[model samples]
Target: MTYELRDHTADVAVEATADTLSALFAAVADGLAAASAESVPDEGDRFEFEVAAEGREALLFDYLDRLIYERDVRLVLPADHRCAVVGPGEGDSGTGPSDPDEWRLTASARGVPLDAVAAREIKAVTYSEMALERRGDEWYAYVVFDV
Candidate 1:
């Protein structure tokens, strides 16, 4: 897992890279968690969710947005995640993002309760300066958020 927090004026920018799409998404989720909480508590509950989009970049956006939504709804900070890219059908695995409508994701996310962690409160995940692309066999995404 590789990620960095780049300075983005009023907001925060996260750049993540991985050998696979699922790992890339997980890194981005972790970056968000790191930005939101000072330290993510280890003893937290895990939950699963599925998110899909017409394109790889959109999928990343929805994946991060879902984590934020879960945080606000459950009053928890997502500390970690494991994800897999799949075909359109449930439980179907894929080689990773290739087309707009062919890829989807299933993610298991762990969360530390809001009261158990120091929260920074990320407002939303923004598309401004956001991108997801393939660099050789690795995948990379640069996302900006409204903090």
Candidate 2:
């Protein structure tokens, strides 16, 4: 998985690519964490969260937004991300084995105390220029954050 920070006029955009959808989510999460601090320690307190949505793009937005909320409330710089993105009808019996219509994301991350990192304030994650797509065996996403 890989991600790069894109220059935005008054914000920052993260473009990430990964081999799988779940890894893509984690890469984007790592991008957001990098946007918050210059350097994040490898070790931190464990943090877990979940979000559900009708589409992948919206789920990405919610996931990042939640991280921002967690950062502000818990006073931590979230990092070392891991996540799994599941289906819209994950538990429904009618869907059978075919792909479901909705999506869900469950993420586990390490959070370093805000005081321990040299940090910057990211106001929020925005929908402007946001994107998510798949090409062949790879997944890609572009997300803009209101810095």
Candidate 3:
């Protein structure tokens, strides 16, 4: 998995790529964690959450939004992430991408309390220019956050 931060006019954006959809989500989480703090200290605390969406686009959006919510509500700075594309996602049983509400994401992240690290708050994740797709052998994601 790999991720990079990009300039998004008045906001901040992340470009993430991975060999699988699961890794792509994890990479995006890692990018968001890095954006929250200069350095996320390991060996702190752990938190896990699950998210479901109608489709890939909303899945990505909800995944990031969920992470941001965790940081804001729990006052934590994430250091590590583990994400998996679980359940019968779209196109699982020769049904094509017709059902949008059947996809789910299971994520586990570790972090320290916000007071223990220097962090920059991310206001929200936006849909502008948001993308998730498969190209060749890699899955790519592009997301912009309202910072």
| Candidate 1: C-alpha lDDT | 0.84
lDDT per residue for candidate 2 within 116-143, as digits (tens), equals 8999899999999998999888999999
Best by lDDT: 2
Stretches of candidate 2 above 4 Å error?
89-100
lDDT of 3 by residue, 32-91 (tens): 887777886665778888787777788889988988888778878766889878545334
List clashing residue pairs in candidate 3. Answer: 54-100
| Per-model TM-score versus the true fold | 0.89, 0.90, 0.88
After aligning candidate 3 to the native by TM-score, how far in Å is the CA of 63 from where it should be? 1.1
Clashes of each: 1, 2, 1
| RMSD (CA, angstroms), candidate 1 | 3.8
lDDT of 3 at 102: 67
lDDT: the better of candidates 2 and 3: 2
**Deviation of model 1 at 20, angstroms:** 0.6
Candidate 1 local lDDT, residue 39:
79
